[model samples]
Target: MNANPKILLYILMISALGINTPLSIVGIISQIAEYFNTSIAISGLYVSSFTFTIAICGLFIPVLFSKYNRKRTFVSILTVFAISNIAIIFTKSIYIASFFRILSAIFYPAFISIALTVCEEIAPKGEEQDYITKILLGISIGSIVGLPITTGLGTIFNYQVAMSWIFAINLLSLILIIIFFPKIKGKAKSYEMPFSSLKSKEFLLATIGIMMMPIGASIVYNYQPYFLQVVSHVYTYKLSIFLFIYGLFSIFGTWLGGKLIAKRDKATILIFQLICGGVFVLLYLFANYLIPVLILILIFGILDGMGYNLIQYIESSVIPDSPELANGVFLSILNGGIALGIAIGGFLVDGFGIMSIFIFGALFLLLAFIILYYIIGIMKMPLKYS
Candidate 1:
């Protein structure tokens, strides 16, 4: 069945907003800590727990649900997601809030995987990447626009209000999905096993390389609110503005990644990692200066957006025969990396200081650069230019 392109885009964008609702809480984590009478590190678990649940669930959700009706499954998942967000609105403790976050995250990977599959199915020949890029724009916009706005709400009113905002958006998405999303049939029972794609050495190496990028980036990003408060002396009101600007540039970066990856995938990603590492190091060196910090935020935001799409492009390229499985593994590893980054960042915050996380971020990117180089350079894997 042919789906209306505009309606499909709306569905994808709204679903992404719902998926990213938990992340919008990052800016108010300090308030959460104070509310629960806990440490900042513990308060950070609200983000980490959600990401970690997605990581584990992503590994198997696609494979388990591959034969289910895509439209029905997606609608059902969003319903549960809405319920989880509403539960968070009433929770009085950080730990309870985190538990509901985890419950909501259980369906996230499957939702993303199905969305990617639907995009691929409808994309005309030779235009798959463009379609993929459009869907990823939904993700970028959710981060760039949704995140800062919800963060501002939480800052102005309270966390419950922020969560209510998320619930409202998600509810709208559910209504749209029920009305406009096309009914796409699932794969046949005899479809190839998802794990079949993991047997390739190139795919495995590419996954590892992509995983490192998030771990590196999240080390700094997960604690950005606290970092800005302590190191840059950015007030809570101003923090949302800075995040909004960072997100604006990030949208550009996402678009740029789609454009550049088509020409020179390996070279583009390699240079991005190298420059990203340098930018992190620079962030550490100039942490105390507002001018340099603003510049770096713009640069890092772009790099951050580029990383999201480039990594997905590479992952799918390595295992072209299994897009659903590849996308699932990509989400799993990506969020797994984020969880790891948060853990590592928490350690640094407790021991060295928040500024130290940037240095460690640079180190992780260096490692990603090395593995990526090894795959394209030493292993001589043929680059597929779409």
Candidate 2:
């Protein structure tokens, strides 16, 4: 794949975008809280808002880009994403920071959708999944690199300084994307509308799967620091160490996910992985000691990463001809679930206690599993709905 200049450039740019944004910032949530003199829960809202925009913008991006020039559309989105990160660096108030975050989130889904489409457009027809997986690996790398970079930067400079570092990285990455991505000779056939496919059973099921997996994943992620501080009595430095370990091992899980999809059906992998995800959420809830918490989170991240990739693969499978729209819708539902999970988990943490957040996440995922199972079973029936 390195022999292909476009593919190499695509991976580099996407990896920077993915790594430099959310995961990097998540490692600094407490630092953000300290900087703004706000509660950590409120600081968590910055991450949640990023997810909210990604979800809400899913419905409009495909339609908006359908009529726009692909290269300009992508370049514009990347510019917006980079500029918003700059806005984030300068904002003093948490609310203002969150506002910029939401703005940044708007352009993200569009860029991601376009990137996947670009991969497909470049691939040798039958190898779409291969290209798509390699592209998605950027997200995996982001999760890996973002954590360490955030922690290391935070250790040296303040949270705002760390945010600035990520922004600079994004600016450099966007420049690279502008330089290397090939220009389209004319409007591609991919610009066609894809709204009709939203109603398909497979598409709908894949959407639900994407939504639920994050609910389960975020329950743990949202409260991980609290889990370490309160349950494990681990200090901030130790917590960062555990987080680094989680990021490191998760690369294997992500790789495993791509390998699994290459060997089997996407829907089957998503269903099984989601069920395991729920189980991991429950395990995380009950974990109290430092060792158990560390072990479970590592397990959780690995499983969640695998489940996340499978969810995307399933969505790509739903509308194989339109991976752009399918991936957009997939990202939208997934982000919605993430926001919902954080909000719901916050409520549970306050009302029922920290462990209850895990219960709530597990329940939401179980609900998704049941819904998809019924939907899949019904789709096998003789009668068909249009």
Candidate 3:
């Protein structure tokens, strides 16, 4: 398929904005709880259910859609996403809203898998990682810029307004995609199944490592607004600003991940996991101090950003033959980790306190560090970087 690389990149980014809109709502989760007259932990299911659906559906969605036109599949998924957001905006019941959320999520893995494959196809030889970084910038932008703005709207207005903003973004992405996205051919009929890659011991070990890091990070990140409010006593108005700053620094971290992986490879992820684990501990240790908490947020934000690219590279590297299936599995496991973390975080919040989430986050990261170290340092499984 003939297309402008830059334009394709922008389309991918915009689509990412739509795909990641559910995450942006994390800032307004409390408002959602209030709207539905539900507990905070119950409200968290909105996020977790969506992610869990992605986790389950991501495993097969890519392979199922692998034979269709990429342009059509992406546009169709965005349409469904836009419709789902509309449904969420009008729904008064949380259960109804969550149903739509899951519906949209069912298609998310397919879109992500296609986007990753397109990036690989368009990239110049040896610059695939750089292209992937640029693509991930869309996700970072959605998190930092789009997330804060929508969250502010929700805080100032209502959660429905936030849902409306998501709808608008998806609408915009849909229009842009229909206008500019080129038709890319799908995979050949005779191709390897996505599950085939899982047979390798190295892929399984690497997948475990990737899954652990997100589970660790999600425990804190999914409930960050709560953490800031309860532990640090951050004012309501300033919460959006803090989230924005965290997301902005995360963009820099994404860029840094692209550069670091070239030189350090698996070592970069290991060090990042270690630093992130320590950062979580510090967050728990100095929860009452605003300045120190803010500092740790910055540090964690950078590492979180780095995790996106570094982990994506690792997943793709381990199973190079089936890019669509590989990426699909990556998205599945990533969201699976997020769902698990949210569940664990909610449990901690209800049983112990919000502060306990960080402690658990640190422990999960420690496990991730060990698994990654074994795979790269001891097992000596070869990643492209290694």
Predicted model with the maximum lDDT: 3
Give the candidate number with the greatest TM-score: 3
- TM-score of predicted model 1? 0.89
TM-score of 3: 0.90
Sorted on lDDT, best first, the list reads 3, 1, 2
Give the root-mean-square deviation of each candidate in angstroms.
2.8, 4.2, 2.6
Superposing every Cα of model 1 onto the true structure, what RMSD results?
A: 2.8
TM-score of each prediction:
0.89, 0.82, 0.90
* Candidate 3 deviant stretches above 4 angstroms: 30-43, 91-96, 190-196, 284-289, 349-355
Error of 2 at 380 (Å): 4.4
Put the candidates in TM-score order, highest first.
3, 1, 2
Give the residue spans of candidate 2 off by over 4 A.
Answer: 1-6, 9-23, 29-47, 67-69, 90-100, 185-195, 266-271, 274-278, 281-293, 377-386
Error of 3 at 237 (Å): 2.2
lDDT for each residue of candidate 2 in 1-386, tens digit (9 for 90 to 100): 23474565465446435533565577677888988899988987776677677788876776466556656776677687677777777877888788777777777777777666667667775665566666666777775777678766876788877887777767776676577655543244445665677677666765775577778677767787786787678777777777777766776777677666666653555366465655566565567555665767787777666765666766666676665677787777677776777777778888888777667667766766676666555564111111
True-structure Cα RMSD, model 2: 4.2
- lDDT for model 3, please: 0.84
CA lDDT, every model vs. true structure: 0.80, 0.67, 0.84
Taking the tens digit of each residue's C-alpha lDDT, what string does model 3 give over 138-179? 777876776677778988999888888889888988999899
